[model samples]
Target chain A: MDWQAIRLSLWLATLTTVSLLVLGLPLAYWLATSRRRWKFLVEAVVAMPLVLPPTVLGFYLLMAMGPRSPFGRAWESLFGRTLPFSFEGLLLASVLYSLPFMIQPLAAAFAAVDRGLVEASWCLGESRLRTFLRVIAPLSWAGILTGVVLSFAHTLGEFGVVLMVGGNLPGRTRTVSIAIYDQVQAMDYAPAARTAALLLGVSFLVLTFTYALRRRQRKPWTLI
Target chain B: MDAHLTPSPQLLADAERRYRGGPTVEARFDIPEPGFSVTVLFGPSGSGKTTALRLLAGLERADRGSIRFGGATWSDAARGLHCPPQARNLGFLPQAYSLFPHLSVSANLGYGLASLSARERRARVDELLALLDLRDLEARHPGELSGGQQQRVALGRALARKPALLLLDEPLSALDRPSQVRLRKELRSLLRTLDIPTVLVTHDRAEALQLGDRLVVMDQGRVCQCGDIQQVFDRPTDPAVATILGVETVVRGRIESIVGGMATLSVGSARIFAADPGGLGWEVFICIRGEDVAVERGSTPGSGSTARNRLPARITALNPEGSLVRLSLDCGFPLESLVTRQACADLGLSEGDGVCAVLKAAAVHLIPHD
Candidate 1:
């Protein structure tokens, strides 16, 4: 059944989701509020993953993380480990693949906040950081939750990019999607069916939770 | 108690800022009297009244200006000193009552009192809840409250920090007429009790007259006139200022003659008498408020009246605004007069009827035409 691959894939997805959240929040906030002329340039770059083929992006990432590249050489000298075909490489690839899942919803949420509320907070003598945390964060919880769930599920189902970067190494980089492919090639229908069913169930459960949360937000009395 | 022994600090602001594709604001304001007084910046919609308040609160920066509140220099462009809004030690209430939708009323009030101890913060919030009469709704969120209730909560939140100065931008413009009137009285008493210097911005002249001890009239991003409420209303410096102050009838006239400090102005075919507060050019505008002009039907000219100027006019239109009636009259020149409904009924005034419009020389003001 290759349970180790399933576990590795889950771990990679969880780590990628957490890291994307930590990095995407501030980036989305800046994109929403900044009046800079070049803001659309950054937005276009972030949205590239949503339209680009996963294998094409993976090919470029593979080149960037190779031994001859400056970043790759610096990483090797610092950590004594190369990036490609490693779990860390897979995590980074998944984060980039799922970047739009984290940022777009969050940017929309932040832009929806009342500008007057933010100005009032400053007038009440609150620093920008304090106002973001105390006022903006709580109000945008629904959108943030949606972003988190989508990022997590997208990373869980990742295949083409993970395959191109992580390179199908058992117990090291072989994710559940790679395991399913390997099982189908080996004519092992039973384990392939089992892994496919598991993935489907998990994805369905995540979507159900997202929908339930949205419905609850619409009728807040249900929360009490 | 000892702080009161020292003289109150004045707020002096002289700043100019130009918005991209918007109006340019050049403001020069000095309020020598401080402590628990409401100063209204009154003007039309685009006159930069809100801009002036924002500059004072450090919400908007000015190009090459200085703001000094007593000894503390809030902004000095040449010296490169500019304080951020958080450090300005003032409370601001924007036009929209910006209550935090996620926070309860009590939490919203407590959001600004971070400097106080936990117990002290609770005490302060409780005090504001009581002061604003928001004790019963402390646990409710802003969305659950009515518009007036949310406004009070916003005010309480601003006041919770015990700021040195308070700035309000059209605080009552969002309310209905009945609620606006009720909340205005409540807000006046609340401001008196807080005893903090306040700068309020409004396009409404009645609000300025009722709430402000000192009124600054702005037009086209400049201070057109500034003085006590009565002084500004009675004697506007220019025709623009007079127009903004709600003078209904402003007729351009050339001075026909000046006799004994009184000027006879030839407005169209009618001669209007006005006090010549000397130094006025030959061309001036005679400003008369609608309420100040009295209407009498079929009254003999210069009979049973001591008014200096009386003209026979035919009524053109009659508009009933609530309890008062506004009559448009054509006495060779357009004139408007406001009278109570009872007075309108007693005079039996109607359209196409001839009536005499009585203008006291003292009530008629002359301003230099722009």
Candidate 2:
């Protein structure tokens, strides 16, 4: 098995999950509460990843992060490096691929909170930020946890976007999925099976834990 | 405006709002004296009672008007001045689900005490728990407690802030009848001890009567009457106010004569005397509540009774409403009387039975025909 590819995949997944969480919290909250006229437009854009093919999304991202694009030129100027086929490129691709996984659950959770509870918090002299932290955060922990775990797992299994953007750069961007694909094409069935088994086991464990936690939180009496 | 005339140090409000698909509310009210008193905003559903409370609490903005709470301008649309709910420093207990479901009862009580020291916060929480009889449930979350317990916790949390004003919007409407009655009494006593101005909005007449020190009758987004509880209950400003107060009988009468302080009025061949004789030869409405109309057996009016207005009537219908019996009488004009079930049984009262409906002249309220 290619341990380097496994390490790269884990790092990319962790970084993508963290960045998605940071970006998704406010976006989800705004979607849940804002009454702006164009809110649905933003919501649709966020959910585009769920419906569009991963390769299609990665194709646009690849062009956007290339040297000819303004963003790509700015990135090279500021960071002193190109974005295409680098670790940062793969990380950005993974974040976009897993954006919906991080936002949908969070938006639903926030929207499900009793509005009366929010108003009551405000009436008790709590600011909106404090109410979100002290009341909304605790109530929506389950959705947040679901979003985090789903994002991590989805990013780990990414293939089409990583290949479209990273271009099989060996140790730099060759994640576990690309390694398995390369091994399979080279007629190396043993290594491919081992790597595939590892991914399956990790995904199973994460999904099992999330499902169990959700079940316990939903029907607390079942825990007893 | 006189330079020496200072604004009164009371809670005054004049608010107007027009919703796109809902009612247009134009409410104007002033509490010239606001201290340690419960002012009930009573009306039917869709009457804008809750809207008025929300405007006072800054939960909803008014289109045009100003609110001055004890000399501080909370909201003034003309000047574009408004205070958010957080800065208003007021407690609001909604109809239900006011307690934070995730917080323990004690933590819920301690939430608004961010300015207090840790020790003081704990002491304050403990004091509220004891005062609200919630000491045993301090560790329980809102979901773990009963509805009545949750309501008590919500009340305790609201009072924990020692807010400048307390706004309660049907706080007891979600409880069962027995729990509602029990909690209302407890709330009345608890509110009496606190020296805060309270505005409670309720659609229940019984709750309003039992809890209100001052009453404001609202109808169609307007305050129809505002006065002391008994005075408003006794003499509503108009027919709409009387109907909202659950005044059972409202019969039109023509003033016949005014001898001394008593005024004799004729109602469809029946004579009734009222305590007020403002103007003779004018039509007026004689309003009386079901509970104030006493019933006695036989057609002969109580011989030695002091009640000046006694009419012989025939019982048309009898309704058993829990502990009390409602008797529909036809004393020339329609009238209703509410009596205890025991009194109903002792008199052997039934439909088509003849009885004397004794209404004291003082109980007879007169509202001039509009």
Candidate 3:
């Protein structure tokens, strides 16, 4: 029973999901609605995580957050702590690694909104921000929730990025997956099985929720 | 030109728009004294009618030219000026009613009044609910309402801001045919009571005729004609306008001779006289509305002073259209008459019957074919 690791992983996942929601909303909306000629270029960059190997992402992140890097020095100066091998670094890595999970669903949902409604909103003298809050946000809550759940699940089960950014430290940086690996390495099969089983159950339940929300939202009547 | 001497038109637009690599739509028209007028942009599908409406609504940018409304420049491509739809001071009803599915009817109606206090918003929404007769559906989401109800909510939402102009794109197109037929008159009456200058875009000929006071007929991305609805219908500028207006009978006629001001044109084996709308040379296309054509039993043919051409013809087809049956006739040239079903029954007319097809010479309109 690695209570500390489990708590750390849950906290990190929660923070990462919240941060992604705040950051990903505008980014996904821009990707969905922008008519700029370079829109596809931005879309490609956002989707890079979906195709890039997790290990390769972890390696670059590790270099970027290293002591010699500008980001690492800025972070150390601000927070008075080095970024690598810390929980904050692990949180940053999880957000980067799990970005597509949050953005893809939100962007798809935004693009699915009827363009006529947006135009009608403007015709009624509503500004762009008011229209989004009153019309678009209400229509897209299901997709937003799905994105939140997927990003949370994705951050929870991460292994390579967490290991590269936050090395083994039981309470501060070590996560449940790392705890399971440690248990297995020490030949403690019983505890490792318990932890792995819990993680698997949680992941399955999260996915079930996401699919259920999506299935209900896909009914045409619910939109038009 | 002193600015005070000539107060500019309420709306003066001469603009062109191109979508991707598709056809470029060009339009030029002005509305003076538009307090209670309905100017319709009418054409067949792909005739750039909706594009013209969108340009006026500021939902689209013109590739070139300008749009001036109420002394303000809304769009001028040469000056790199484009006003957004939010600033256009217009209401628009897109083809799909596009009511917000998640908001209740009252909330959707009040969606545009964010600048108002909550009390004022509620009052306005309540007023619209009564105006559109949507009081019962106020609490229902759009998904829960019928198509007609959804349309009213969408209209109410657009009217919430009291826009200077109303733009509707195929306002009744989202409904089934029966609903559309039933609502056409109702919608026209409603627009009249709204007391707003409006520009409507529709491809349906009946919808165009019933709803508009002024008509701007477009074809293949150009404004072919613009005038009073009846005038344009009676005197379309060209063959393309004739076709778009759904003139029930259009036939090529070569001039046999000119007597006084009447040109007797030989169409097939039948000769019809039309007032010489001269300078059409010897070739012209004759356009006649089905409603203008009259038919009766051939045996009781009376010498009537009104109708000039009374040809004894055989019925070719009878297609039932709503309250009327369209009688397609073979009077040496194909002709069509719209008669009530009761008349159709009383005359005992069917697929093959002999009847007198009567036409007033004034009902015949001529336009140059070339």
Candidate 4:
């Protein structure tokens, strides 16, 4: 049983979660409140991953991260190396795949806030930023938690994107899901079964823990 | 001996409000609008009364307008000055009475005074709890309180800031009718004691009349009329004002005589006298209350009566009041008269029959139309 693959997967998931939250908070905020021109176009693009096949998204990620693309060249210039087949490549792919899971719930949570509550806070003399942090963030904490958990879980379970872009480099790009696939192909049935069981148990425990936490918090769950 | 009157330090300082136009809101009045003690923007639903309160709160900005309060200019479009809402120092109570759901009443009251020292904050919160008669409820969350209690908590929270300008946007409208009346009375006294220029926005005319020192009648977006409640009620400049104030009976008639400085006129199908003197053939609008008319049986005998105006009327319909009967009569043009149930029974008055309608000239108000 290769432990590096498991460690890499955990690292990838953690990095993916952090990056997604950092990038997604602003994006979700914009999606929730922006009255900018062509807002719907941005929304449609953000939602593309939800409906588009994972391989299609993975294929686009491959093209964009490849040396043939402008973004790829910029990354190469800045990073001094190609992004594909690297841990950085796996991290980028996971962030893209998990973006919607983090954003949709957060956006919906922000949207569900009582507009009057926000207005009242402003009238009470709280600044807009202060109101968002003190009133909105706390009020939508459950949804934000749900988003983080879902995004982290989804990133951990990522198969297509990691497989297409990872190149299965031990201790670097080879994550747990790909490791299990490799083990089964090599006729290492016991190791493959153990890795699969670990993944399944982790996923189940994560989902159950979130559900229990949400139930205990008794947050006012909304449909959208 | 002439005593010098000192201008209120607060009055000399005005709160500022800046908005970009989404709702009607309160704007501070450093240079106050003339003849208005507290300009209460009032109208029916969607009439922008709450919007005006929001403007005063600096919660929203007007595309154009100035809000000056407590010797400060909050918003001035031409001068390019706009103050953010909190800087305006407005104690605002939105329509819902939004006390912080998470916090206890004491905590909610102390929220605005976070910058104050702990002891002072506690003292302030305690004082507010006592002031609002919420001492027992200080430890209770907003969800556990009754609607009226929640409103009191919200009021306490707003008042804790000791703001120079107070803006109440239908603060009592959400409570029960009895609670509304009680809280409204309490609010009036509390506001009066503060000496803070307050703007109350409500769709109810009665509420406006009850709460506002000066009423600003707004329709659509324009200020239609702004004046003392009684003054506006006594002489509305337009039919719109008259209608909004519930002074609906407008009888156009020709003046037949001017005796003792009184105009004796034939109105609709009835002869009536008004306190206003006018020449013959003069047309005017005479306003009379439905309760002013006294009903009598047909072919009544002439008797000693101080009533100035009398007309023979046929009762077309009888509507019920609490303990009185409201009779609709065809006395030239349909006239409404209220009589006690006992009077209705004694006079044997029912629908479609004869009756004499008697009223005093003092009971009528006259508006000249040319």
Candidate 5:
């Protein structure tokens, strides 16, 4: 069943989800609350992954992180490694590829918070940051959960971005999706079927848990 | 409502803010004098009533003007200075009592005491819990409480910081009719005990009359009149103010003569007397509240009813307004009288019936109009 590939996928998805959490939350908050006139442009850029083909995104990501590129050279000088084919590179690619999955739900949740609560907090001498942490963050638990689940699930199932950014390498960048493809190509149909079944079961369980959580909400959060 | 403390509006403001695709709301609050009492920002919907309160709270920025609260200059457009609500140190109850959904009653009350020590905060929260009469529901969340309970919790939370002034926007509008009326009395007495200068926003005239010591009448995004509550409600300055004040009957009248401080005005085919507004223009708008007009039989001109201007008229319409019945009459011109259903039954009044509309000479207010 390519258990090594499965483990690697899990690790990549975990790191990618964490990285997106650190990066996406503030960005999502800003996107949700900012009143800037040109904020739509930033929103569009963040949402690009939703519409752009994975292969197209991967192509640009590879170019931006190539050995000859400025970012690639800077990374080599600091981390002493190229960014195109390592685990770190795959993690970064996954984070970018699943950006919208994390951000859209988070932004929607933040925006959906009752504005009256925010104003009340301010009136009570609480700063904006305190209000966000105390009032907004707690109410937005559902969105955060949805973003985490979607990002992790999407990164785990990614095939095209992984193929373009992280070339197949055993114990390094060969994620479960790549392993499944490799098994099918090598005529290892039984193992491919076993791996595919495991993925289907996991996906089904994750979706069921998510829907149950949403349905049980006393106050319904956004469907997304 | 009380002389509990030396409270002052201590606030002065002349601000203007232009809304997108709407008229500019110009709030001119000049309560430069001292002593605490309730001041209501009274107006109809879209009349900038809430904006006026928000201007004082530092929530709504003025496009051109300044606000001085206490001794500090809160906002000045020319100087490019504006204070945030957090620094304003004011308790603000928004139209909706938005108690934090996730927090319990105690936590909601303690939200503003972040700077206080843990023990002090707890004490303050407890004080509020008792003051607002929510000790039993301290552990409950806002959703677990009823409408009135949630309102008290919200009020407790706002007062946790002991703000200098309280600004409430339609504090009772969110509740059901019964709770709203009940809370209306409770809130008034509560504010009286607290003794802080308050600026409340409400479109309901009954609320204004019941809660406010002073009233600021607003219309079309401007202050039409500001004075004592009873005075403003009884004698609005102009037709616009009179209409916004809900002065039920306003008819065009010409001053025919003035004698002994009483002015005789002629309407379509009837004559009436009002306290002279001497030289307040010959063209006048006569404003009379329905409650001030009493209904009697047409034959009872000198019956014990002492309202001076008892004009003989025919009933036009009868509409029920809560416990009272409003009788529309064609007494020379249109007029309205609010009487009990029992009074209607006693008089056996109905549409097309002749009746005497009794109005006091002082009840008729004259506003000069072009």
Candidate 6:
């Protein structure tokens, strides 16, 4: 029943979801439309985290966030501290770990969009940026919704990455999954059950709501 | 390159593209790949006709070709220059009638006019609505409209910008017969008035023949022939061109006689004369327009008058050609002539009707098939 850990976990997951979307959308769009030879390479790298253990990604991220590494040193110089064991650190780790979940569905959805529609918009003299905002984004809402919800839920359940990078610091880095472990280790079964139930209920409700909204927006031709 | 060699305004206005290499498909035209006042890429489907249209639109990059449009190098693969579709300033009505379903008719029309003033945009949209006969449906959403209506809206949207070049990729393919005819007529008049170089891709030969000022016959990703409609129709470059142009029927017979610019050739018991002569005793493919053959109820052949190429034939089949009827007749040879339903009704025509098929010998063109 540690409130700070629960609050921190929620914050980390939310921040990760938001940042992932911001970064993933453009990347997905590029990957979806690109004919470059390196596009496959880029896709393969994005998909690496899906197959690789979360701890492996977390280990690299941990090293990358430490003050000894170049990126970590630059960050330290900017912020006056190491990023590990911080909420921002957890967000970055979760974003990377959950990237494919957010991007794949979105990219698939965006790709599924009738290319004729895109070409039509271009022929209408709408800029690519405007077309994406007005046509691609609105039409691909279902896939995007699925991607966002999946990323958020996956980030919420994220364990190995947060444990390795965020370092289970109560009131700062300790998320609900880590908090549940701590409760059970201390033989506090009741609070662990409560937290586990909370995670399950919240994730289920969010996913259900997102799916319902998608169904509502579904066109008759989209039934298949 | 000399400074004088750089294209002038008139040169740009009459841009021509001659692409070679790559998967050899025959399109040999000197046309600006972009910014044409009316450059129609006309041929049957799978004829590389669509590719030619796309090249002009700057949608598909050519493998090895130079495209100059309105004094700009749209694409020159050998020179490693390719202008993207955005820079082409083209109005393309792609197949599937890619109307913005989210936007209403007016909004869809106004989308391309963003570069213009508000008043200009409004005026343009209004003019298009009137021109397309869509003034009454401005408020309707694309999804709510019929396929024909959506097509018109798409055409309106494309025309709203008044692009330097217009590319129509089988825009009328999805419409009903009536709608197709209506739009075809409207499109011809509209294109003429706008004077924007247009490239129309279609599989419908009649549509191409009617709409294209100069038809470019393409096959297997190449242009087989390119010329004015009559030139191409009268004398196709090859048998393939003849086939694509739907002029494949040719009668091989020695010239028995020639009279008044028409040569009579004896094929089997029936005599077929040239509507337009090739040469005396020269083997020829007698090209006859399907509409030129008229059916009669009686076996008595019509006396040769101004209308020539008369034959005593049996009605083999009747095929519908929109409002008209096309009769496939056994004129002692496998040949078909297209005529209207009103004509058939007036003649009381039917299957197995023994009739003398009246045709003008002048309509029977002689082209070298081999």
* iRMSD, per candidate, in listed order: 2.3, 2.6, 3.2, 2.3, 2.4, 2.9
Each prediction's TM-score versus the true structure: 0.80, 0.81, 0.79, 0.75, 0.79, 0.76
Give Cα-based local distance difference scores for all models. Answer: 0.85, 0.86, 0.85, 0.75, 0.86, 0.75
What does chain B score (TM) in every candidate? 0.69, 0.70, 0.70, 0.63, 0.69, 0.64
Clashing pairs in 1: none
Query: Which of the two, 1 or 6, has more TM-score?
Result: 1
How much is B209 displaced in model 1, in angstroms? Answer: 0.3
Task: Categorize the docking of model 3.
Answer: medium
lDDT of 3 by residue, B1-370 (tens): 6887977889999999986778999767878765778898998888888889889988888889999998899999999999999898888888888887777899889987878999999999999999999998899888899888888888888899998888888888888887876676677778787787889888876667666778899888999999887678656777578667888776667888888888888998999878885555576667788999889887365864677788889998998989999888999888889999999999788888988898888898876532
Pairs that clash in candidate 5: B7-B35, B7-B36
Give the TM-score comparing model 2 with the true structure, all chains together.
0.81
- Per-residue lDDT tens digits for candidate 1, residues B118-140, read 89999999999988899999999
lDDT of 6 by residue, B1-370 (tens): 6667844432121122344554544334655343334445666666677666666666666666566665678777777787788777878888888886767799888987777888988998899899888989999888889998888888888877667777788889998987776566667767778866677788876566557666777777667777666567656788688767775344445567777776778765678766543322354445567766766667665554677666888888887868987677787776677777888888888888888888767677654321
List the candidate 2 regions with Cα displacement exceeding 4 Å: A218-224, B1-9, B248-370
Candidate 3: tens digits of C-alpha lDDT, residues A189-222: 9999999999999899888877876777633322
TM-score of chain A of each: 0.96, 0.95, 0.93, 0.93, 0.96, 0.94
lDDT of 5 by residue, A84-159 (tens): 8889899989999999999999999999999989989888988888888887877898898899999999999999
DockQ of each: 0.52, 0.54, 0.50, 0.38, 0.51, 0.40
lDDT, candidate 6, A1-224, per-residue tens: 77887787778778888898899889999988897987999999999989999889999999899888999999989988789988788888888899999999999988988888898777676678877887788788888888988998898898999899988887888988999999999999999999999989998899889878887864422211
lDDT of 4 by residue, B1-370 (tens): 2225554333321222334465433333332432224546777776666666666665555556665555577777667777888788778888888666656789788877867899999999889988989999988878899988888888888888887677788887888776765555567667778877777778765466556666677666556676665456555688687667664354567788877878778876678878863322365556677778887677575689888777887888898878988787877866778789998998787788987888888887764433
True C-alpha contacts between chains kept, each model in order: 0.83, 0.88, 0.90, 0.60, 0.88, 0.69
Highest TM-score against the true fold, candidate: 2
Better of 1 and 2 by TM-score: 2
RMSD to the true structure for each prediction, in A, is 11.1, 10.3, 11.0, 11.3, 10.8, 11.1
Off by over 4 Å in 5: A219-224, B1-9, B33-35, B248-370
Poorest lDDT segment (10 consecutive residues) of candidate 1 chain B: B204-213
Q: lDDT of model 4 at residue A93? A: 86
